[model samples]
Target: MDVLVLIGRVLFVVLFATSAVNHLTRSKAMAGYTASRGIPFATAAVLASGVVLGAGAVSVAVGLWADLGALLLAAFCFSAAVLMHGFWAEKDPQAKMAEQSHFFKDLALGGAALVIFAFFAYAGHDLGLMVTGPALSLG
Candidate 1:
């Protein structure tokens, strides 16, 4: 059971962890896209975003201060979805559909993070400020 929980934690963070490296390696291209979305200081934002993602990934994966990690991820994901994936603002049908998908995906992931935060932070348990173990478990 503990092993499974740890596996789940690893799986949850793998996407962000892998993408954090990509974000840094492809900063120029990513920043260009981010700027096109009207994000100010696009290059710096890209790098900062990468850092946030990496931090969140590490904290959550290691189950150390996971609530804070969850908050970081949730805020970033929600903001990105709104700023980058505004499907309603797109006119082209295909483009709108694509953006909608991206928006939903981000929202779902963000919502999951918020839920994780609530579980560890608000639940009469750990308050999510600190994690005593490497994984969350019913035991």
Candidate 2:
């Protein structure tokens, strides 16, 4: 079970980790797309988002401060869904469908991250964890 949980954690972070790499390595292209979405300081935003993603990936993978990591991921996902994948802004039907799909995907990812945050931060469970941090403790 521990091993399975560990695998799950790693799997969950793979997309974020890889996307972070892309954001860092392909900043110019990514920035151009981000700029098209009307994001201010697109390059800086891309780089900063990459950093956030990297940090979140590491934190979640190691189960250290995972709640914080999950929160960061959730924020990134939700923001990207709204700011980057705005399907309603698309003029072409195909583009709108693609954007709508991406928008939903981001929303789902954000929702999953929030679930992770709640599980670790509020449930007070340490099963299958290497190390834990001060939980978010919203209550």
Candidate 3:
């Protein structure tokens, strides 16, 4: 179980690290791409996303506040997948494939984030606060 958790964390870190590097290095292209997706303040958005991605990756890799890192990374990925990669624009085969791939990847990442969150919550880790009661309230 430890090995599996470590592997999952490493994978998430690697994925986000690569994305962060891309966003940081290719700011103009990323900004343009984001703008094309109807996101306002594309440049600022890319920069902010890059910061979150990089920070999340580092935190997860170091096993420091990993749950929160996973949550933030999941949010970034979900937003990018849904807002940037709209399914309606499937005219280009390549674009369609990329968009679909990102969408599924983000979905998987979100699941991973949930798993991490559950682990931290159950282990009594200081991961923010549960405002609505127990983390896993069945009722």
All models, RMSD in angstroms: 4.2, 1.5, 5.3
Better of 1 and 2 by lDDT: 2
Q: Which of 1 and 2 is the better model by TM-score?
A: 2
| Model 3 misplaced regions, further than 4 Å | 1-4, 124-139
Clashes of each: 1, 0, 0
Estimate TM-scores for all models: 0.86, 0.93, 0.78
| Model 2 lDDT tens row, 8-104 | 8899999999999999999999999999999999999999999999988988889888889999999999999999999998999999999999999
lDDT of 3 by residue, 1-139 (tens): 5566567667768878998999888988989989988999999999899999998787676666665776778788788778987866779988898888878888888777767656754652333332222233212
Candidate 2 C-alpha error for residue 138, in Å: 5.4
Distance from true location, Cα of 61 in model 2, Å: 0.6
Candidate 3, position 38, lDDT = 90
Least well predicted 10-residue stretch by lDDT in candidate 1: 126-135
Give the Cα error of residue 22 in candidate 1, in Å. Answer: 1.4
lDDT of each: 0.80, 0.89, 0.74
lDDT of 1 by residue, 26-83 (tens): 8898998899889999989989899999988988777786777878889889998999
Could you tell me the lDDT of residue 19 within candidate 3?
Answer: 88
